[model samples]
Target: MAHREPVVVTDEPTIGKLVVDASRDVSGLIQKEIALAKSELRVSVKAGGLSIGLFAGAAFLGLLAIIMLSVAIAHFISFTGLDLAWGFLIVFFLYVLLAGLLAFVGLKKVKKVRPPEKAIGQAKAIPGAFKGKS
Candidate 1:
C-alpha cells in the first residue's frame, strides 16, 4: 500500500476576506436604512417649517397692518375733515374684511394639505414585517 497525502486548495476565499466582505454589505444596508429614515423625517420637518413660517409672516403682517391703519385713519381725520370716530369705524371694518379674507385663504390651503403618502405606506409595511413571526 502506498501512502497518499491530501492536497490543499488555495483558491477559496479565506474567513477573514469573507468577514470583511460581509461587513461591507452590512454597512451598505445600514446606510440605506439611515437614508430612508432621513427622507421620511424630511417631509414632516419641511411641512412644519412652512407652517411656522407662514404663522410668523401672518403675525408680522398683522403688526404692519395695525400701523398702516392707524396712519390712514389719522390722515383721514386731518385731511378729509372726517371725525376720528368715523375714521376709526371705517378702518376697523376694513381690517375686519381683510382679516376674514386672509383667514379664508389660509384655511383653504391648510385643508388642501393631505397627510403624506409615506405615512400610509409605512402603516401598510408594519404589519408585513411580523406576519410570519407568530
Candidate 2:
C-alpha cells in the first residue's frame, strides 16, 4: 500500500516535454538499430541460401557430366577403330586440357569480382583515411 511521487506536473511542461522528446529520440534510435539488424540478417540468410542452391546445382550438373562423359568415351571406343586403352587415354587428356582452360578462365573471373564498397563505406574511417579529413 505505497504511492509513488507524481513524475509529471501539469503547470510545468518543460521537463515533461524534454523527457518526451528524449524518449522519442531513444525509441527512434532503437527502431533504426532493429531495422538494420533485420536487414543484415536477411542479407546473410539470402547469401547462405544462394550458396547452398548453387552447390546443389553444381553437384547435379557434375554428376550428369560424368555420366555423359562415360557414354561418350564408350561410343568413341565402339564406333571408332581405335583401341580401347588409347581411346580412353585420348579422352582423358582432352578432359584434362579442358579442365585446365576452364580453371584459368575461372581464376580470371574470380579476380575481377571485387567486393562491393557499400559495406566498407559504412566502416569507421581509419587513421590513414581520416588524416586529410581532420
Candidate 3:
C-alpha cells in the first residue's frame, strides 16, 4: 500500500470574511451585467441606425416614383390634343383641390377631439384627497 498524506481540515470562514467576499462577488456580477447590457445596446443602436437609413432611401425612391407618375399622367392628358401646359395646369389644380379636401377633413377630425374631463376632475380632487378630505 502506498503511503498517504494526512488531510488537514481548514477552519470555517468568519462571518465578516464571508460577507465581504459575498459583497465583492455581487459587485463583480453587477459590473459584468452592465458591460453585457452595454455591448447588446451598441449592436442594437447600430442596427437601428442602419434601418433608419434604409427607410429614408426607400422614402426618397418612392417620392421619385410619384413625381415620374405625375409627369406621365400629364403627358397622357396632352396626347388627347390638349395643350401640354394645360395638362400640367390641370394636374396642379387637382393637387390643390386634394389638399383643400384633406385640410377640411382634418379640421373636422380635430374639432371632434375633446379634453379628458374625467382625468381633469380626478386631478382637481388630488389636493383635497391629500388633505384627508374625501
Q: On residues 51-132, what C-alpha lDDT tens digit does candidate 2 reach at each position?
A: 9999999999999999788768866786788777777777788779999999999999999998778777656556556677
lDDT, residue 41, candidate 3? 100
**Rank list by TM-score:** 3, 2, 1
Residue 4 alpha-carbon offset, candidate 3, angstroms: 33
Stretch of 10 with least lDDT, candidate 1: 125-134
Better of 2 and 3 by lDDT: 3
What do the candidate models score in CA lDDT, each in turn? Answer: 0.88, 0.86, 0.96
Candidate 3 lDDT over 1-134, as tens digits, reads: 99999998889898999999999999999999999999999999999999999999999999999888878889999999999898899888888999999999999999999999999999999999999999
* TM-score list, all predictions: 0.44, 0.48, 0.83
Writing each residue's lDDT as its tens digit, candidate 1 over 1-134 gives 99999898889999999999999999999999999999989999999999999999999999999789787876776568877777777777887999999999999999999988999988888888779531
Off by over 4 Å in 3: 1-10
* Poorest stretch of ten by lDDT in candidate 2: 121-130
Clashing pairs for predicted structure model 1, backbone only: none
User: Which candidate has the highest lDDT of all?
Assistant: 3
Candidate 2 clash pair list: none
